[model samples]
Target chain A: MFDLSTPQRQSKKVIALYAFKSLRGFIFFFVFAAFGMRGFLEGLAFTGLVLFVAATSLIGPVIQYLFFKFHIEQDEFILNKGWLFKEKKAVPLERIQSVNLEQNLLQRILKVYSVQIETAGSKEKELEIKALDESAALSLKQALLDISNQREEQEKTEVTEPEKKTVNPTSNEVSSTLLKLSFLDLFKVGMTQNHLRSGGVAIGLVVGSYFKFQDVIKQFFGDYLDGWEWENLMSFASLGMLFSFLLIFLVFSIVVSLITVFSNYYGFKAVVYQSHLELSMGLIKRQEIRVPIEKIQSLEFRTNPLRQWLGYSTAYIYQAQSDANKASKVSIPACKKEHIKILQETAFKDSVVDATIDIPCNGFSYMRLASYIMLATLIPTLVPLAYFGDYNWVVPMLIPAVVIVFWSYMYGSNSGIVTDKGFIGFKKGWLFKSFSISPVFKAQAVEKWDSIFIRRREEMHVKFHTASGSNGLRYFKKDAVNHLLNYINNTVIKSNRNWM
Target chain B: MTNEQILTHSLPDIESFSFEKHPKRFLNKKLIANTLYMIPLAIAVGFLFYNFSEFPWLGWSGLGLWAFILLFSLFVNYKEYFVRGYTLREHDITYRKGWIFHHQITVPFNRIQHTEINHGPIDRLFNLCELEIYTAGGSSSDLSISGLDPKDAQNLKSFVAGKTSTHV
Candidate 1:
């Protein structure tokens, strides 16, 4: 066991980790100075400047490693850092949400691991220990979790029976493996990723980097490249060459998608403990994530057409989050139906399995489809009319118009709600289907929106807000919406279970 | 559970609650703030009219548009004051605002993370304050109720704080 009461520094290997981090930051500056200022500085002077900068950067990490210290004091976790401007932070033990361990290639080679401590809310600054041996990291995590569990039990005892303080058995150390992916499953996961989205992102990155490179060239050789137009250069390419270029770009994007999927999800495994779940994965940068079962607000299962055909869906576990941008979500890829069933059972017990009543959005769905059609065709119809000043241009645009109408109709018809006594679920999307389920007791707020038109038509939109996110149902009958809202409100008010 | 338990008729309905309107002095404060904002734009148009003799139509039209906007906004503010209301129930508080696109949100006291009372210079002049209630459900779900008496805001804050503690 590691002593956590006294202030302790990270493993000595952290010095090397900090030096490499600083070197990565300075690499770009060094390259730019070497090439951009070659005509202005002598070779000897340039070498001396580089040596001095490198030496100073290395020394900064040593000082940082020497000053950083952390320890557990009373019921708070305290961290002290900085040599000149000392900073101190103390987070209450009960406020800690999760402790994760991560190991990158460098840390693995050095036989060390980095630990990340996240508190309950996004407002709390996350704490990270640069390097720790395996035993030290595990002991630190165990100590923090034990203190948090003890405080929770104390609170419960105070509320129920103050005279008797019972000590429970240490069953938290016992865990069972829930799911593990084989090499074949990993390959299937890589193959079934959303290729179109990855391709769009790759294209965006290429375009962005091209523009940045152009700016750099203009800065360095502005006088040599005056009066040069990119349009003239692009006009020289033939149609055949353009087609082949597109083919190459498609191949490149597919390869990038495959690489990303394989590296991030290799050797994935999930284990269930008494009150939490642990997930470990990755090829080069391994991550171990712990999510407390009670903190989970919602569970989402999503799949595309190809994945659905292959009997695979991705599961996303959303926990209580104070900021939407920093939402804590753990995604498990290539989960079959059986795996999803087990996960759902763990998160929500039998509530989801008992959800049988289905409430489909039907009567007012036509109005939503009409609005979608109008919005989608507005730009396409206007651009042709404005450019040509003829009704004939709209003839060619009718093909795309029909496709949009069909897609909107499918979208409206596919969306619906499902509910039971203890859980409420929302199902949406036609091509990219998703089903999200949350316990009725986790609802934080309820919202009802009505427009003048919808109000006159006796229809409304309802949203159920949770700590993770919200689920919305649009164009529903007023009476049904009122019933659902009342049921949710009653459940939230009566249930004494903790929301987070 | 039986079907009778699922019947929602016996449950408390949010639509049936009676909402209370803001104090009348809050309307006066809104009008004063609106006029203060218009004064600077009015002076700028006047300055343009005096400096540019050749473009008299430009200055006159600018002044006309400015006056129209100011009058329109004052009318909207007055009408909107009547439409906005709030209600505090045993377990939750509901705030409803907006006229054309109406929306109502209800947040339970048990879910609130913290509360704050804000008193701006103009609000102080009117002896009013605003109460903000935050939850772990992000900024959009947080509630901000403006135009309240200082004592009432403090009482409301303490009541919510007490309720939250019991839940914890």
Candidate 2:
């Protein structure tokens, strides 16, 4: 059992890590300056400057390691920190959303883990315990969970009339392994991870970086390009050159994407216990997270055209948490489409796959989408073309105009669906499709808004605000908005169930 | 899926629901407060005009834009006072506001994390208060209804507080 009253300090190895991290910037600056001014300065002065920065950075974390202390009380976790300023903070146990345990390379070598406690509050407020022994962090987490459960049980007993003779059970013996991904499964996911989009991103990055440092690079290659002018750079853009460039980019994007995916999701495992779900994964940096089932706000099943063709879907579990760490989204990526159906049904405690009542948005939504595209892209394109009186720009502008029209037509055909059971789902996007399903009872609020355009066309935008975030249908028929709002509000008023 | 429907209640007519409007004096208070901000802005523009007399078009355009903003805001404030209203139900609260872009937000009692009553300096002058209802969603409150009578705001706050305690 973990004691609450005794304050504890993190592993002493954290001091060295903190010192090295803090001194990195100063070290880089000194090294760069010493090399740049090697002709002017003596070698002794450079070595002395390096020594001074290293010694200065070492002082702060050493003092901090001696002063930082933490302990847990009955319902709150208290942290006393700051070597010079002396600051104390107390976080209530009930407010904690999730406690994450992570281990990086340094932590693995030291045989310790870092703990991050996230609360359902503002983004600025998060508690971190760096470099705790693995066993100690686990025990501390178990103790905090136990205390939270006890408080919840006490609250429940008080709310209900007369306590039962039999004490309520705390833990269960049966634990089911919900899902596990193998190396082969990971390979498939990497192959289908939108390599085309990654290619676009890589091309953009290379172009941007070259332009940003063009002056430095040009000076380095002083006389290498004796007759190569700036205008001649694009003038050499033949069809053969473009094809070879694309081939190289394609290979680069696929290699990078596969490496990134495999490294991040090497050993993923998901298990379902009595009341919570546990997920552990990562290759170089490992993390373990626990989420209470009741805290889930919505389940989003998403897939792009490429992934759909490969017969895989990604499911995201949005829990009631502060949006500080967007990377904390619990996801089971590249699962079979059939597996998604089974998982969705099991999580929602209802049947959702067989529903055949998807209603598409108003047909006029196409006009709205097209106008938006024109205003965002074409209107700005015309500004410079008109100013420079460039007739050549008109042909280039026609290509994007045609592409925009096609994109709008596909996107505007999006739909919003509500089952007879009051489960709401929204289908959005064209190339990168995303589908979100939210239980009506979990919705915190419902909003209906009408702009002048929507009102004139008798359409409205209906938004379902959840604890994690919000999802909505854009420019649907007015009557459908009323029906959906009433259906959702009725579910909340009558269910008498907890939202979180 | 079960054959039984999840929606039990007969749909209420949203348009037919009676809404409680703010006091007419609230409009005057808003207009005064908004126009008062223009005094400093006008003073700064005047200083710029005196110092840079060479750029007559710049000074005149800045002053003209300021005057236009002052009059436009007065009209918008007056119109908003009429359009903004709220309705309290047994299990939920609905706030309807906006003119060009109309919005109606309905939040249930169980979703409300807390409630607060605020009396700003200008609002206190007119003996009015604002009731802000917060949910666990984020930094901003879910609903904020301003220009309410102090006693009414107090009563509503307590009512919401009571419901939140019972539901949560």
Clash pairs of candidate 2?
A: none
The reply for model 1, stretches above 4 Å from the true place, is A43-48, A157-169, A211-230, A233-246, A324-327, A351-357, A362-398, B1-17, B32-75
What is the C-alpha lDDT profile of model 2 across A473-495, one tens digit per residue? 77777777777787787687776
Tell me the tens digit of each residue's lDDT in model 1 across A1-500.
Answer: 67899999999899999999999988877777866886788678888998988997899889989999999999999989999999988989998889999999999999899999888776655788989999999999999988998788788677755564645627777888888989888778777787777888988988898786775777778887886678876988899989998898777767877888878988899999878899999999999999999889999999999899998899999988766237388999987877777888888785463243376665336546565666676777678697888777666666666666667667667777888757889887788888889989999998888876667777778888998878787877777877788788778878777778
Model 2 C-alpha lDDT versus the unseen true structure: 0.77
Task: List TM-score per model, in order.
Answer: 0.89, 0.85
lDDT of 2 at A146: 69
Q: TM-score of A-chain in each prediction?
A: 0.90, 0.87
Cα shift from native, residue A71, model 1 (Å): 1.1
